[model samples]
Target chain A: MSEATEQNGKHFPEKQLWGREGFRDDPYIEAESLEVAGDAPAVILPLAAWLGLDDDVRRTSNRRIGVFVAPGESIDPLLDKLDTVPLIALQFPAFNDGRSYSKAEILKGRHGFKGELRAVGDVLVDQVVFMLRAGFDTLEVTNPVALKRLSASDLRDTPGYYQPGRGSAKTAGGFSWRRTPAA
Target chain B: MYRYDEFDHAFVAARVEQFKDQVERRLSGELTEDQFKPLRLMNGVYLQLHAYMLRVAVPYGTLSGRQMRKLGHIARTYDRGYGHFTTRQNIQYNWPALADIPKILDELAEVEMHAMQTSGNCIRNVTADHFSGVAADEVADPRPFAEILRQWSSLHPEFSYLPRKFKIAVTGAEHDRAAIQTHDIGLHLKKNEAGELGFAVYVGGGQGRTPMVAKKIRDFLPAEDLLSYTTAIVRVYNLHGRRDNKYKARIKILVHETGVEELTRQIEAEWQALKESDLKLPQGDIDAIMTYFRPPVLPERPEGWGALAAAKKADAGFAAWVDQNVTPHKNPDYGVVTISLKPIGGIPGDASAEQMELVADIAEKYSQDEIRVSHEQNLVLPHVALADLHAVYELLLADGLATANAGLITDIIACPGLDYCALANARSIPVAQRISERFGAAERQAEIGELKIKISGCINACGHHHVGHIGILGVEKKGEELYQITLGGSADEITTVGEITGRGFSSEEVVDAIEKIVDTYLGLRTSKEENFLAAYRRVGAAPFKEALYGPVSRAA
Candidate 1:
């Protein structure tokens, strides 16, 4: 892997995901002053006290956290998070996956999220163009594969297809028909 | 039949323009491949084994002849001159290029259609009974609610990025024709004693690796709270669904891990919070949507409808086709004709360009210009005149679409398996064909009686195998195809997850095992008329298991 992942210690390999539930009582994870995106349970401050975040406000910092983009994932949550982060990396569970692509596009084009939009996981050389089109300026190519040697130009290839679908279907098969002005 | 309102029209236009800009940006190398993948998928586009598959939602399986013709135009002009109707009641054009999708979407939009959310983890195309409006057993048409769900879910700000793909299906009949129990969220419409409409909501049902029948979260929910209650369920799932492991990300997993009772409590809490919000469905809004879906002006009972007896006597082929394809209509003079998209020896859900045009013409002529795609890999002309059944039958016969096997063993439901699907472990079509050929005999299918055979290439259960009376799941073992057979699952109100009896079957022996099970049911059934599902339920899987694993020698 690149210098980014010199060793798997004290850090996630590519991205750190903070779902509703996360690693608790783990030495690697700090238990204090964590900020949740869009959703939080009742009594977070109290939980902080319960977990002893009361003594340490700095524990939540330095623990790099990120947002998620899934198939039919709402774009607004990620958009709201973009305003505060310098780099927002998207994870594609599978290579042929499409949901995260929409998130990247909305983040860049619509929400104006130009700060490092990274593509992580199942990131293949061939799919580089799709990743580029979806507005992921940075790519965390899995395992520092052969594609790591690609120049900036190579990763930024033109993605074919002209349809507008990002942030469109909020759900699966949740499509709408668009009428174009006749030529 | 639900026409697009201005809001819907405006939303699609904005989305189209947005995609156009994205495509332009991609072509200019302004973005990288990593950035563009999800954008394409949200547009109902996918890069598959052969070509880019563009899946267009046929909302609730309802389509007008005009829309069908528009689909045909796109197929003939942009694609390989045909589209495959998916099990979710959506039509997929398998050969569209990535470059042409926007233009295609534009064309679709002109016809009040778009390919949004045809893929991805979002709430997918809401599916309903193909015979929704015209079914004799229906108390209410599920299309309006499906449309409402479509609107509420479309580009919904809070739910675009979910843990995984979410699917919902609706059925309004006492007889569950829409396979509602097998969806991530399923709803059944029933009337209360006070003549008020309500829904019976089922949650957490899914057909992936862990095939499950959704538990009833609420037996009867008031109609006004449908949207709000559903929003509560999805929100609860979004907040609590597991994201650490992809396999366990589905709401089914959440419901399973949390226990349905507590999940129900959480949903109740969420609903209680949103009980009085704008999310609460208003009577006027429901009426407005429902108004667009009322029955067509049908003719009075015709003499030829009763004269069908004479016609059957005169034409045996017509009789067979009628017996298989025609369903009793609420209007006694009419019938809903299920056009079998599962033509024998053909792909289970595909339609040729010619078939589309022909169906379009047939729809305009005899079926009130209405067409529906059933989740079971078939099409329905929801308003066919009973007197014109012969005419429809003749045209269908010429096109090789006259398969008289709806709900019979030969009418197998199959997913696009290893041949095209990237996720499939083995091929599912050939198995479906083998079974179809084995049960192709009219006499054999007639003897077997009302068997639902659903096959999935993998555990995703895209074929709804879990709820099938006989579910065949294809998996790879030692680099060879091994089929696992599960028996006695029902997708109806009494939904039961099928149980695997024993060892997996080879591709060659899979159909034979199905054969053995059917034979046992036939032998043990009290009446020749007792269908496979009824017999399996009455006698349980012991008899079928014995028939499949080979009879345990009685030690005589």
Candidate 2:
């Protein structure tokens, strides 16, 4: 039931969040009270709280449901419910703690999750490229340097990548040594 | 040597521009030191004791004369007129200004080189046998596969931020000159029953505060499955490796905690999904890379044999140099020459800017313009013809690069200890100098035979002390520096970590202790042919221990 501010105690409002379509109003809000699934139109609850919901409530609710997963938290419990969840936000508690990168890959590449994958907390400019490549479709940036770079579209990266990632076909082709230029 | 194509050029250029922008932001105070530390590390810049140390990658230990000249230019222009070649087959400049790094990187890119992934928690420069293609005993060339790994591991997003750094080594010979078993992942290139090239894979081997030999995970992995299998292993490690403690973060620790059986199972499971993905290497791509490493055509220089024999007869120094520093090449007319960097009483692994340029000139005129940096802190001309030996020897002799100690006792490997490294607890170079001078007599060294003495200033084992025939570890005890010795360690086909021999010795007492061990070995050895390691393995540490600490007390 903790409010979803920046995990590192930084103040990044919902407006600072970015997605594929650029900055927009965030429709989903973190459920403040997990006791009863509140009345928010779209609520993002902790993984345990979302899993604790009644089968009927989870399956038949009219409100959109998302889940926030912390680092080291297994995604096995949500495997069967991937279809019902519209978003899965992974926390980076610290930029160097890369446990969330593995979770994101598991969700997108292993489980074939089609929902939005967002990276939240401690997101910095240097890690943005890696986050994107690790299947993060959105980022909740809090660092001022990262925010400036993101706004200016100054995310510098090499033209080609050495490893295949989610949606790699549209961006690159063939083996890494002889990769075709990204479209 | 692998040449950079247009795509490679663009890739390095993009990285240069990116780093340039990052440096600008750091200078403008937009990024704090904490934020910029990792960024600089990714580009191979480290904040050392006094100044920044820049480590430039020499992929697979292969370099052209032009590239070597550029490295010399970098040393002369930016650094203090010298550079240190590291055990990982890369060159490190000890002093460089933070602001001037961008310009240095730009210059490196011009020679198809950069410092990407040289540090940080990413995959480091892939090393191979210095005598890769020319080694007479090689099953196949390892450089092409090494180059393939280099390209794949570079800028790999999923693995850029791992629990700790990863190192991969490849060797094509049965002799294991690349020290495969001491690497995180060792690939031994060999042919199968049907004569198809593949690799015997070993994983989790490392040397540090805790040194462990890598266990064989797979008997043989097909060449096409190289990338997929490697991806699977790294992915498994990235996901499950311990994050709470940095010391236990390496894949070796995970291999220990998870047990090899379970770790192998996990790696296999992860690899199953990726094996059929785009990670599978195409035959054409591998062949294309192999095309770049094709041995340069050398015309038969049969007359050099007669000239070499005459030169040897005339000059005993030249004879000793040829007898020690030269190895058989794949081509009978050619010989693999190891130019020793360890002069008597000189710092190990250090080469002056002028010496580098001279080596480059020698490599160009005689060695088919190819040069290689050995992990043992030496330069190699892998394809020198026998006919050119006298000329090459004369050139090297004049420049003090012709030290006749290839695998002899005086050919020591020592890391930059308290002298330059911030992490070092004691000095390594001075000890190496003392040991080198103590055994400087050519006849004495030749009589003692091959003895490797690797020294590290700390437990990090940057000097590969764990694998030394006689390993020396420097630690700060109380307020004084103490040196500990280990015996019978080797980094060869039969790899074993050295065992510590009783208590440590003070700096003054260390060289004498080493001399005592050598004298004991000479006394008890089965024959002169028995090297220090073979003799130690046979006699065990009992004799060396008794020689140092005296026989066990019967009263106890």
Candidate 3:
């Protein structure tokens, strides 16, 4: 039995780890999955493998692919394949390395990537706040405390943000627009 | 002195609660030391050699009378009844239990202060010109922008986990008292030919094992682009800065390796993309922040020169104090009074609870309730009236706060070297104290004339030895403490790194070596008017080398 995590109000089994694995055997998305892998469905590929895939194969692939990006790793080669891929799982390697945050921002804000942006590896309770603001809606955290914190409804209770984002106040990346009295 | 609104209040209160939880988890052994180290550092809790030292941010070095009083309270109630003012313009309580940090942070939050971002890999405290609002030669007050940065960088979600620590400094004066050139990002607030406000953006200047002066990336960046431009620069650094080696991970190394032009091009591209984003500060927001930092308006008062002159004549001690401790304010009737924390044979920058309260009381009574902590490890009452100087001095003297050595040779800047730091190779305070006592006489200091001696325990340069007029760096040699001296460094507008003398001296020999170097300067100087830095610059290092190591040939 597989466990499911919440995403956009839907539960999806997180069977896709960042490696050269065979696609998930799903009945509903066979046509989409078979485009590139010819019958294997929902395959997850590491950055190198994804880059090695032929351009024509990647362009013709109707299946939603997943690619993992490490901290300080350039994602320029993957930009052209972003439209075909449905998930971009950026790796944190270490919680201290923050390159993933900028990677997410470039994917979402600059490249207009509408796919699911996920943060993987060393996802702790503290970094979830930053990850969400940087446009990572899906998280793969192994820490039990962090997972519990993520599911709690009060996770967003911290007051006014300084970064302006996709939504208005009270949403991710929103800032308080309060004005002060005259000095 | 930006007062907290509902948002600021809620933000800090929530942060306190979150930290309380973190502390609980750490104490419960749920989080390992490695897991908790970064979190503790981000909150300015350091596990030093002896105990956990909590550093509290004093934003832009400005504090209210009430805030200063609260600091005194924390010192008396929690740690030892004293606090050390750091060169970063913050305060460190040398002794605090890990369990008490959350409570200390809670106490700090009541006064709109916290230790958040004081350490760790995030943007640290945004330091500015200590004489900001009342400076005689300022284009604009830099505190407002500093406050803006403080808010934006506080708990900034994205840039929190940088490859290395980031520091930003701002200056509004041409004198560069804030030492902007040695920071990761230096902003010079200025007016263009049209008299419109803007910033001259400097990037990648820093001091540590490797010291580099910041380069001017943009000669004139519009005031409105402050946030966007800063964000762009950090983002570029975040994506590309080296992470393989901790020592070379600083943005300066990145700037050096990538070349400034390429870095600037990347930053410009990032800024262009962010210009239309919400990171751009609207005019109203700038005005709102700026209003909080406007100097209090004062009516013209009598010059009171005759009364001051009479007081000076009556007491020679008061006259010396006035001559060294008082600075001219932009307003003719007002004065900026520097309360020296470096007293004879005393630990530099450590003020007892009583001393803190006494200064707070003086600020409330005579300086419009405003106080500043300079990067030189001293406090300032920036708006004291010239007529009230005598009264302020009397109170300071009583509380042991009046040392009358603001910029003199005895006013040494020393880090809490091996005494408290985990990284220090040798002790700095004892050396600083010995030098202070050696040159403690008011007459001797007056003769030396504006010499700065800064000491760092190690090459991390926390003591700012790189820019000190006379810099001393302590190193461990053969498992013993060794001191290396450098000469002619200045953090002023003309920034220069110091040059190391031939050999390192033992701890016992360091003080005598310093005396010989000063004697060389005194002998070579043409007149009393030529200070140590000037004479050293003119004569170069030859005379000082000969004096310290016998002869130029033997010196090498």
Candidate 4:
């Protein structure tokens, strides 16, 4: 378990949140109580808690809101409410459990969600490339070794791909054969 | 054989470097064994009972003489002097140090060969009909499509982490030699009424603890939509397949529980969205890949027929080898040569480095540098001219590769069970050896014509025991090894799972039990023309069961 650390007068887990640009401060805190809507600047809640909020409260809340979806949870309930949330975190209970990958594809490709898609748990360096391909823009990495590798920018990957993904299409439309200079 | 272009070479080389780093991290204790298991498996490295076993992919079972030579070099340098050819058309080295694997892969890469995706939950090596181009009945070669799949599924980010391992097989012939019905996705290449090439797609077929024949979802899908349609099927399975139970995780279980009609509807719906997407293959690209598999420009050998006739009349042993191990090729002057790896009383698929190099040399000299490894654990020279048959036979005879038992009783398919694999309850090779010894007589084997004996070490069915005409399953029962016999299964056009007979036989009694079954078949068949499968199908398993268990067990 990650220890809670204080920064900028806000307390959150010592999880390194990163995006394509670089490491950034994690603003959203986990909602302690869904019964009382707190006045925090930003709050992240479980799927059920997010779904339990009143429509008027959801519309009127000044705080930035996000929902974390568990492994087997369906994203159907959040489809119509995509515009109200700026971040949607998909949890990988274990690195091998890949149900969230389908969810990520559905959220980005089928539902056309423009929000920041984040991978929350068990995020490792080996899987980060796949996470990026599956439409995750942000990652909450807690593994110490993965963090060290990420900080050193030592990600290992091939120069070419045989299939297309949620990432930018590098090659002009033909057959999705994209290759970069060897890393 | 498809030569590796610059892109393909770069891809494989980068993967080699990536794995080398992963291995280094594992040795340095930066990555624990638990974290390193799947990574190593993706690169075809497995921690076996005795040592690390590396399985290298022989794409669609086709190889060049140079590639075969490279495999021999690897076996001699990094591993023991021998390598085992698996039913998936891949070769496995039973003993290779973990540190030596990177070097082995580097050697493989030099010859445009690799072990990528040979194991693991991701898509495994795509297999096809071993006699793809040379088979007389084939409409077109299936290797091109298999190559397409091999590239697309190489490191597919979305489908790499699947619920369970997936296998796909393809066949272009009317007679199904690739065992398409026993794969996760089986593609039958054919031409429709409009004379357009397409595929009849079958999904969710597998053999394991629970064996099920694949169900056809689409009668015909255009060739251009191959990748799109495949992506659709895999996506649906990856999202909705059962993950709670590892045994029930295969797509076959999903098709069973979800019902064929419903699963087909889901796959079709998913395909509808992706049919016109960027995944749709371009015709030019398909043509480009197809060019790699075009039939070799064979020289006319009109003199071969006269020369072969004279040679056959002179040598009886060469005549027997020709009769048993050769098949009709599309070219009139050529014959397809099956180099049997299963010598009498020897291990089923084990080939020594010397044998491999010898095969390479023969292929280079007589077979247009083309070699294929059959899924039934045999090597094939797909384009040997009839004129050169005697010379090839002499070369093979000197090395003990001239086994005149292609479809005979001695050509038993056995897995490296308790001897090498960590997941075995009983030994398969020794049982195979004993059975081979019992039926080593050529005349006796010829009497039991076209009998397929497949043995599996455990319930995982890697040896494909379920589809054998006489399937033998080895299991551990009450601290002793027991063998179960199944009857009447076939993997041809009309595929059927074998039926288990009553009771089991101890290791000592198993060979005798098989003898009784064979004896019963010989006694009951109307004529020698009736093969074991045809006879068993016509009369049912009653006679064999009676022969195995006697009259009293029937009443029980």
Where is model 4 more than 4 Å wrong at Cα? A1-13, A32-37, A54-56, A168-183
Which runs in model 2 stand beyond 4 Å of their true positions?
Answer: A1-11, A32-37, A167-170, A179-183, B552-556
User: Per-residue alpha-carbon lDDT of model 1 for B1-556, expressed as tens digits?
Assistant: 7887655676687778767766776778865666676767777877777777889988898888888888889899998888888888999888887778889889988999988888876788899988888888889998888888887777554455677889999999989988888888999998999989999999988878887778899989999898779978887776578766778988999999999999999899878866886566667777777877878999875875677878888998889989988989999888889898777666898888788888889999999899988888788898887778888989999998898988888788889898888889989999988888777888878877898889999998888788889999999999999999888888887888888878888988888888888878878898977777777778776776667665773311
In model 3, which residue pairs have backbone atoms overlapping below 3 Å?
none
lDDT of 2 at B48: 90
| Candidate No. with top TM-score | 2
| lDDT measured at residue B240 in model 1 versus the true structure, 0 to 100 | 70
Q: For residues B1-556, could you state the per-residue lDDT of candidate 4 as single tens digits? A: 6777778898899999999999999989998999999899999999989898999999999999999999998889888899999999999999999988999999999999899999988999999999999999999899989998998898877788899999999999999999999999999999999988899999988899999999989889999999989988998888888889999999999999999999999888988988888778777778778777879999999899999999999999999999999999999999999999999889999999999999999999999999999999999999999999999999999999999999888888888999999999989999999999999988889878889999999999988899999999999999999999999898877889999997879999999999999999999999999999999999998889888888778622
True contacts kept of each: 0.00, 0.59, 0.69, 0.49
Better of 1 and 2 by TM-score: 2
Error of 1 at B476 (Å): 0.5
Q: lDDT winner among the candidates? A: 2
**The TM-score obtained by chain A of candidate 3 when compared with the true chain A:** 0.70
Which is the leading candidate under DockQ? Answer: 2
Error (Å) of candidate 4 at residue A112 is 3.1
Candidate 3 lDDT tens digits, B187-250? 9999999998999999998888998888889999989999999999999999988889989999
**Winner on lDDT (2 vs 4):** 2
What TM-score does each of the candidates earn?
A: 0.78, 0.97, 0.94, 0.96
| Per-residue C-alpha lDDT of model 2 across residues A66-173, encoded as one tens digit per residue | 899887778889999898889998988778877788788878878889988889878988888888888998888768778787888777877876667763333465
